[model samples]
Structure formats: C-alpha cells, structure tokens
Target: MSSFKSYFSIIQVLLLFGYTGFFSCGAGAQQMASEVKEVKAPKLLFLNYTISKDTNGTYRATFINKVLTEGRLKDKTQRQPLSDAGDIVCIQYNDKNDVLDRSYIKNPLQPIVEYVNDDGNLEKRQLNLNSAQIAIKLQLQEATSSVRLFLIDASGNASTDLITTSIR
Candidate 1:
C-alpha cells in the first residue's frame, strides 16, 4: 500500500510539471508575438505627369518625379517622408477596373519609373538619381479609358495606405 501511494505521488508530480511547462511555453510564444511590430507601407506622391496617345494610337502615361513617403500619413499635419535613403517601391496600374500591370522597384534613389512595352506589358526601368524626372510609361488597353496607380514599399514592415491617383 505504501509503494502504491509513492507511485501515485510521483505520477501526480510529473503530470503537474508537464502541465506547467506546457503553459509556460505557450505564454512565452504569446509574449513573443505581442513584441513583434507591424510593418507599415510607404505613401506615394504622384507628381506632375501626363497620359498621351502615341503614333500607333496606343495610350501611354508617364509619371514624373513621384515621391515615396516612408511612414503612414495619419493626417495632413503628420507627414513622415523617408529621408536620406529610399525604400523598395511597388507600383500597380489598373485600367478599366482591371490590374493592367505591376512594377517593383528595389531601392530607387531616382524617380520610380514604369512603362508599358509594345507587347502591352508594363515594364519598370531604373534611372539615375540625378535625373530630373522618373517617367513611368503605361500602355493602355482597348476600352480602358482610365488608369489608377497604387504604391507600396516592398521592404517588409512598412504599412502604406492606398495612395491612388485620380482616374485618368
């Protein structure tokens, strides 16, 4: 009877330790998750640009000297633009409510440039930082009268609100 009591006590202690260890690990995981900060996307400023038709009757748009703001634009008062260096920029162009093309620029010190090729695909080209303007050319499809641009930072952790251009 004494041996039985001892075995029962040992089993109870083991179970208690196992349960405590499990809960501790779970709590630690939760704490780690809580410590992780959410990344924000960068804001984009579409500066002076133009959409014109080429000789072939194809619609093309050029985005000149677009600016990318690093952090969130909470209000008109608080504008946190990235200084010194530039972040990865991803731009998406939509026409006729359809995604026409997507471009990703890695660390663009110059203007973030994009263009549409003859094959009707949107292409992103790199330019020199000293260049006056970063021209983004987008090919417009048939029945796609207007296009909208969306900008985001490809680098992980920056949350960006939807910075859209006027339908044009």
Candidate 2:
C-alpha cells in the first residue's frame, strides 16, 4: 500500500507540472503574436472635399477633412467656401520641399464626397473628375510622412488655405 501511494503522488506531481508548462507556452505564443501584429500601422487617413461650379464659371470648394487614428476618425471640420473663376490647382507639398501641382478646368467640376456608412465608418467617393490625381496625392503623402495641400484658383489665389494632413 505504501509503495502504491508513493507512485500515485509522483504521477500527480508530474501531471501538474506538465499542465502548467503547456498553458504557459500557449500564453507566451499569444503574447508574441500580439507583439508582431502591433508592428503594423493603420491603413488610411482620409480627407473629404467638395468642388462645385459657380455662376461666374469659377470653382467653389467646401470640405470636411479628418484623420484616422487607432481605427477612429478625428479632426473633422467644415471649411470655408472658395469661390473663384479660373483654372483650379491642387498642390501637395511636403516637409522636404517636394511639391506636386495639378491644374484642372473650372468647368465640369468634380465633387468628392465622404460620408459615414451604416457601421459608422468613414467612406469616400469621388464624382465627376478622374481619381488619378487624388490617388497620386495620397501616395505622395504616404511616402513623405506628412503633406500640406493647397487648392489654387485661376486668379493665382489659394481656394483653400494650406490644408494639411498626416498618415500613419
């Protein structure tokens, strides 16, 4: 009887140690996976603007732009309108003094819309104009770390003063 009791106690001790080791290893793997996932950055930071045509054949602009942070949107504002007739210019400048300027006709204005979806997420759709220009701007901003945008009118006036945003 004493021999049997000794063997059973040894088995119980070994089983307890094995169970603890298995759970600790699993917990460590989960922690490592979370650390690896934390290295990735957010996907996109979006800006919304509206470009419309005025009676004078000039362009008018209104925008509500925001930044995406930690799966949430912030820094939203309704900007003042810019009414100017002439060629419209979209300029993107970076801290490195790199600048990209694109010009568009005042007529046949394109509208860029940004709205919240049913899930309370921000969504964007560009109407009328080719999206290539905007895509380029977004790419440049991502590459440069930070970017400042300016919309200029045909009269060489800035339609919207130095709108800036940064991406993660």
Candidate 3:
C-alpha cells in the first residue's frame, strides 16, 4: 500500500510538470521552425523594369512581377540567366535608368561573350555564379532615389509590374 501511494505521488508530480515541459519544448520548436522559414530564398520569376518620365523630369524605374513570398524585394542578388543557345542577355540598370552604365554578368553555363549592350560595354567585373546572384546585384541607390526592377526571362517572358526600391 505504501509503494502504491508513493507511485501515485510520483505520477501527480509528473502530471504537474509534464504540461509545462511539453509547452516549453513546443515553444522552442515553433520558434526554430519560424526562423528556418524566414531564411528561405525567394522564388525566381520573370519580371520587368518600367521607366516612366515623370512631369518633374525624373525617370522612375519600377520592378514588377513579384513572387508572393515574404522574401521578395529583400536585399538579395540577381543575375541574368543563360539562354538555350549558350548565349546570355545582360540587362543593366544603374542606380537610375541609365542603361548605358550597366555591367555584364558572366555566365558559367556558357561562354557568353556577347552578353553586353549592343554598344560594346561590359556588365559586372566577372564573378562566380551562385544562387544569391539576383539578390546581391539588385539593390537600392542613393543617387537614383527609387528604382524598380522587373524579371526578364531568357525567352523574354516578363510580368508587367514593378518592384520598387527607395535608394535614399
């Protein structure tokens, strides 16, 4: 009878603390899951850059075709993709819409010598291709104030909206 009583007492103690322990463990796991999800990369899609000359004599560059994740437009690198014919089309936009000053990003998938403006200008200084290319290249500029980016695919498929960023 004494042993039974002792066992019952132990069970009661465990019941008292079990819920608290379970809740704490669950809370910790929940936090870790959310943190992992937050670090996920944004989806790649075709977007476009729209430049409109405002009445105040300013060219407004806006990015459109946003992926519906919370990670879109976050500080990340964006590199142009290679084409099926071993060619790459480079699209360069300055802090402003001055496309003349754009850099040609080298593509490892192919030897893309012509991946520059028709006027013979290079894009980036040549770097290893990586997953974070787009996020790193697309950024805000203080001189241009606000610039939006659009994703243009290899086949020239694009969305008609703007991904806006404030350079200030």
Best by lDDT: 2
Per-residue alpha-carbon lDDT of candidate 3 for residues 56-159, written as tens digits (9 for 90 to 100)? 43323444433222234442333334333212233434554674212223333222243576688866444322222232233322233344443334465433
For candidate 1, what is the TM-score? 0.29
What candidate 3 gets wrong by more than 4 Å, as runs, is 37-168
Native-vs-model 2 lDDT?
0.50
In candidate 2, stretches whose alpha carbon ends up further than 4 angstroms from where it belongs are: 1-42, 69-92, 100-168
Task: Report the lDDT tens digits of candidate 1 across residue range 56-159.
Answer: 53333355444434443333321233322233222344444555434333333455589999999999987644223234333222233333432334444324
Model 3 lDDT at residue 115: 56
Residues 1-168 of candidate 2: C-alpha lDDT, one tens digit per residue: 999999999999999999999999999999998888444453334455555545654444554564443442232221223445433444445556576423233323455589999999999975655222232213223344444445555576755543454533
Ranking by TM-score: 2, 1, 3
Q: Is candidate 1 or candidate 2 better by TM-score?
A: 2
Q: What TM-score does model 3 achieve against the real structure?
A: 0.25
Off by over 4 Å in 1: 41-168
lDDT of 3: 0.42
Better of 1 and 3 by TM-score: 1
